[model samples]
Target: MIQTLKLHSLKWLCIALYLPFSLAAATLVGTPRGWRNIDWLDVFGEGGGALMVLAWTLLILGSRPAGTVSNLIFAGLGLIFVSLWQDNIDEFWIIPDAQLWDTWLENVPMPIGVVILTLGLIRWYQEQRILMAQLSKRERFRREHRSVDPVTRLASADYLEQQLDVELRAARRDQAPVSLLLLDVDGFDRINRRHGVAEGDRLLQALTDLLLLNLRDGDLMCRYGGDRFAIMLPHTNETMAVIMAGELTAAVSHFAYHTHYEGERVRLTASVGLALALSDSPRALMQRADHALADAKQKGAGSHASAA
Candidate 1:
């Protein structure tokens, strides 16, 4: 609370000073109305409105951070409060008709305040919508937390298996094709031995990002296990899957990653294996891709093999 007050001290000061100024201005320019002449109903309504506006302003200042929207809201409410306060003062003090400034003060601010308040409300609505979208994205990630790999920040092998099962079922129903690409970083264990484990982890993280950039929108990638990644492509045949595998291997070979401490430029290559599903369970399909990967590794770095 103290921090909030400190942050909005200027706004609070303006409000504090405005109250006394309004009171003094009216008292100086007008004569006090007689007890019989004072309208109690107008006093209650206008005074109550001013107090409510003041309370709203305080709440806004307390809860919201100092920003453009908060300032706009404060300004609008301040004007409304000033107008109501002036109107309430009229019940006690009778200003002559010639004192047009008093009339202007009582009447002018209300409409301008309404306009400003409307704009503030619109902006507030837009702000809330953006906040809600980000919250929704975070909620989705939270629900999928168990299916996420901590190292690469990609989906895990378990997530890949689950999604592959769903896609295989859909493929059978629609008589469409689905393919899988299994990629292994060439000699990843050698890199881990040469550099530190931290550097190897960093490389994997960077590689994950690189591979994602190379993937089509509908494709899904997962960290299948250590030094290996899986890509699931829907509505694709063996030929297109093999083509994509080549592109992915080329992307990895061209990527130059520098170590953190030494800044040593390290070139990398990946071997890719392709498999197209055909009356096979998720486990059987993955096994075929694994066999293809083994064949690619035997052929050497940056090689592509297909078991479709």
Candidate 2:
């Protein structure tokens, strides 16, 4: 522990090495009096710069689902924030001329921030490449705009129908089996009434992600209605599809959402209905799944059933 203590002490010592510069800056700012001839342009540039850096920091921290990009942006912004903060303080602090400390604070982070930002951009490029590859592996980013539900930004019923048609045709042509899954959140309307619209919207998005997570890459998922989702699968038989549907129901049942009003967490569950297509349109396949889902709901609200 002695050695570790010494190492940490040294690290902090290095940081303290910059304090003289900070103190000197504070001194300079206190006495820029009667120095109107001093570089006013520099003052304006640095002042505006300080504000911009602060804004960048806030924007980076405020972004949702922040990933590697956010971290990189934060670090870059932090460097700028520190530099500008020091510069702005120096505008009035009257540090002694011989100290040369104020100059160090003003100039150091410029190079450091640029170097760090460059490295971050390099890594960001690599990350984008990996993401693009993953996206291409499953989806062409095909403007499945028709398939997506506009309200929740999830897959739409029409898109589901189109997908079912495509998958069914492909299956029939290859003599492969296809399955359709229909899932509806249990007591969703009651939850909407109790929790308000925002919470209801949150639940729908959460459930969409959960259901999509349980599907294979070859599956096509779409939002069927207000609280219902459908998935179309190729090369899947009834037993296998039913097993997946059961897993989906279980997955959704375990999802607990934290409500804003009471700050209390409540679990949301879904009842599922599955169907297998036998040379049919997307609508027919979905109809079968919907009927089966209705059956599951009638029997019990937290389970799954199927129709062929």
Candidate 3:
């Protein structure tokens, strides 16, 4: 948290400067109220409110990375804190009637702070909705956090099956087609042997990124254990699925990977098999794609095949 706060040091510096400046201005230009004249109740209320706002500002800065949302939120909160701090100072000092700036300080920031804060919250909500939509494609209804692959950063095979069942049901009801594609890296074990296992993991991560680039927004990809991946395509027929499979295989074959340790170039290739859903259970669909993948493997590396 301390390191994260350091990233936004400039914002924090602004708060630090404003705090002392507010205090000093009130003390220098305003007459200090005697102890009997001070309203302790207002002091407690206003000062406590300022402290609370300060704590909130620190939490927001420490938790979020420096960005538009962070900046807007910090700016808004900083303004609110300033307004409250000035209000609290009023309990100890009485500004001369001639000085209108103190009145401006007390009145200006509260409403403007609220408006800016509302805008920041709206933007933050929109961001969360987009993230949830993307996550839905990968995990579907059973959004178990553990159902994500640690190495590839894709959904796990179990998550793929769960989403496949949902898609299959929806396809059957709407009379729309769905497709499943199973892809496996060709001779992945040999790559792991030639290059270190760490390098092999990096290769898989890179390939995952490549495959994602070739897929549509609605397509779901998952890591089906080591060197194997599964994709679920909703509202797609066998023809489109086969074309997508070929594109993925071609992309993998053309990808150039270098070993992190030895700095040696590594050539990568993938084989893909596709099956269209037609009154088929999720297990049957998967089995068909798996068989098709075996057939593709027999054809040679970087080959794509489709099931009848």
TM-score for each model? 0.57, 0.56, 0.74
lDDT, candidate 3, 1-308, per-residue tens? 99999989999889889889988998889999988999989989999998998899899889888888888898788888878888898899998867788888888998899889989989989886887776655665556768778898788877787788888898999998899999999999999897778888999888888888888888888998899999999999877888899889889888878778677888888999889885788889999999999999999999988886
Q: lDDT values of the candidates? A: 0.86, 0.71, 0.87
**Model 1 clash pairs?**
none
Model 1 agreement with the true structure over 1-308: per-residue lDDT tens digits = 56776788988898889889978987898899989998899989999999999999888888787788888888899889989998999999988999998899899999999889888888888987786454331222224877677898777777778878888998998888889999999999989999989999999999988888887757788889999999988788877888899999999999999999999998899999889885578888899999999999899999999984
Stretches of candidate 3 above 4 Å error?
1-4, 20-67, 85-104, 121-150, 279-284, 298-300, 305-308
Ordered by TM-score, highest first, the candidates read 3, 1, 2
Q: Global lDDT for candidate 1?
A: 0.86
Cand. 3 Cα-lDDT: 0.87
- Candidate 1: RMSD over Cα atoms? 9.0
Q: Could you tally the backbone clashes for each prediction?
A: 0, 18, 0
lDDT of 2 at 168: 88
Displacement of residue 155 (Cα, Å) in model 1 is: 1.4
Maximum-lDDT candidate: 3
